[model samples]
Target: MQACQVEQLLADYGTEIYRYCRRLAGFGPDGEDLYQQTFLRLLEADLEPDEGRSPRALLYSVATGLWRNESRKRSRRAAIARPVELDGDDPPPLAGGEEPEAEALKAAENRALAAAVERLPDKYRAAVLLAYGAELPLEEVARIEKLPKGTVKSRLHKARLLLKKEMEARGYGREEL
Candidate 1:
């Protein structure tokens, strides 16, 4: 692809791709690095846009692969490094016009949900993040995951059940999730 085409792709899909990376990497510096590296890989590959493939899907596929590879490396390093506990920051205060209490409650629920998702096994986490968090259709998710559509659906179903149970255990009603 030409430089102009890459610029267009970044304009069109960059935010969604970055958001997906953040969620996939649990929202940290690692996510920011992954987001940068996704576009870099795209540029390096110099791929012509295929009529059958959406650029958004291609960006996501790249991000997912990069994250998986980095995760594997991190795991190997983790085996030798001393683990450190890190505290998560509290959610920002609600802006004007909304009820503060209600906003705070919603934030708490969201944090709980995110925590539950982070706790999920990697396979289930990837399926859930791609399908719901990134708002990708099952077919596209399957294509990116290189899994059968039925297998992706099954994984999504199982992920939803696990998330529901986790939220319930955290004192959230099913409706809230």
Candidate 2:
């Protein structure tokens, strides 16, 4: 793609792509770094999607690889480093709601849902995040995951059950979400 085209793509999709990265990377500086890296990789690859497909899907597919690679690297580092006690800092609530109390509650609920998603095993997590977080269709998610459609569907079904159970266990529910 031309420079102008690339810039346009970034302008159009950058925030959504960054949000996806943040969700995938959990919480930290690394998420922003990975977001940058995804674009860098895209530029390096200079890929054009085949006909009938949006480049948006390709952007996410690239982001997924970058996120997974970084996750693995972090896990390896954590294994080497001695464990430190967690500080239990809660992320600040999202901005803007009619009631401050309602906003705070909503933030807590979102955080809990994110944590629940984070707890999923790698395969299930990737499938669920790609299908739901990025809002990609099941067919697109299956393509990104390089899995059969049936397998992706089965995995998503299991992931949904797990997420529902996790939320309920934490005293939240689908209604709350």
Candidate 3:
């Protein structure tokens, strides 16, 4: 494709692409780095598509490769690193709520939910984050993860059940869970 066409494609889909990267990397400064790397790889590759080409599919394929390579690197580093503490460092509650105490409780619940997501196994975590956090279609997520569509569905269902269980155990209750 031409440069302008590529630029337009990026402009149209960039937010979703970055959000996908955030899910893949578990949402942090590291995720932002991976997001940038995904775009860099796309540009560098010029997104050359072979027979049966779909630009969106090509972009997703590149993103998946980048994420997989980074995941491998992270696994190696994780093997040597000490386990980090998981804290429910609650962000400040929104100030305008009619009930300040309720808002504070909600904020705490949000933090606990985030921590629970962080605690999930990488595969399930990826599925949850991509399906819910990034709001991607299950089919697209399956494509990105290189899994069968049904497997992606299964992973997301299992992940949600696990997350709900953990959040409920933490006293998050139905509203928060």
Candidate 4:
């Protein structure tokens, strides 16, 4: 694709890619960096975004690869550590009129989900995120994760089981996983 095409692609899909990155990175500045990195990697690799198909899946596949490489680097740096507490008091609340309880519940759920996902093996985590978080169909998720369809199903099952266990431990008893 030409430079104009790439720019047009960005204009169309940038928000979706950024949203995916934000979710993947647990919604922090790190996520923004990762979003930019995904686009940069695409530029570096010169992979044209195919508009006929799902750009969400394409961006995610590239982002997942980029994230995996970064994870490997962090592991090599001996950076494994327990999850940290994310206190709500640290950041000011949003101006949008959201009920406190609803906001708290949502924030808690997101944090718990993030921690649970972080615990999953990378392959399973990637499958779960692409399938559930990104709302991609199984076939596309399988392709992105580079696994057979059956393998993707199994991984998703395992990920759900693990997430259920994590939620139970976090005291969300019988409330749905």
TM-score of each: 0.84, 0.80, 0.72, 0.75
All candidates: CA RMSD (Å)? 4.7, 4.9, 4.7, 6.0
Clash number by candidate, in order: 0, 0, 0, 0
Clashing residue pairs, candidate 3? Answer: none
Cα displacement (Å) at residue 155, model 1: 1.4
lDDT of 1: 0.84
Give the residue spans of candidate 3 off by over 4 A. 48-61, 80-104, 174-177
Mark the 10 consecutive residues where model 2 has the least summed lDDT: 90-99
Better structure of 3 and 4 per lDDT? 4
Candidate 3 — worst ten consecutive residues by lDDT sum?
90-99
lDDT of 4 by residue, 108-162 (tens): 6676677778668877877877887778999898878777999999999988998
- Model 1: per-residue Cα lDDT over 44-67, one tens digit each: 888665698888888888888998
> Which residue pairs show collisions in model 1?
none
What does the lDDT read for residue 55 in candidate 2?
A: 85
Which model, 1 or 3, shows the larger TM-score? 1
Cα-based lDDT for every prediction: 0.84, 0.80, 0.73, 0.76
Candidate 1 has what TM-score? 0.84
TM-score winner between 2 and 3, please give it.
Answer: 2
Which regions in candidate 2 have their CA more than 4 angstroms from the true location? 82-107, 174-177
Whole-model lDDT, candidate 4?
0.76
Q: Pick the candidate with the highest TM-score.
A: 1
lDDT per residue, candidate 2, 1-177, as tens digits? 556666777898999888877777765787788788878887777876669988888888888888778778878998999568685553443344434587767778888778878879878988888888878999999888778999999999999999899776765553532
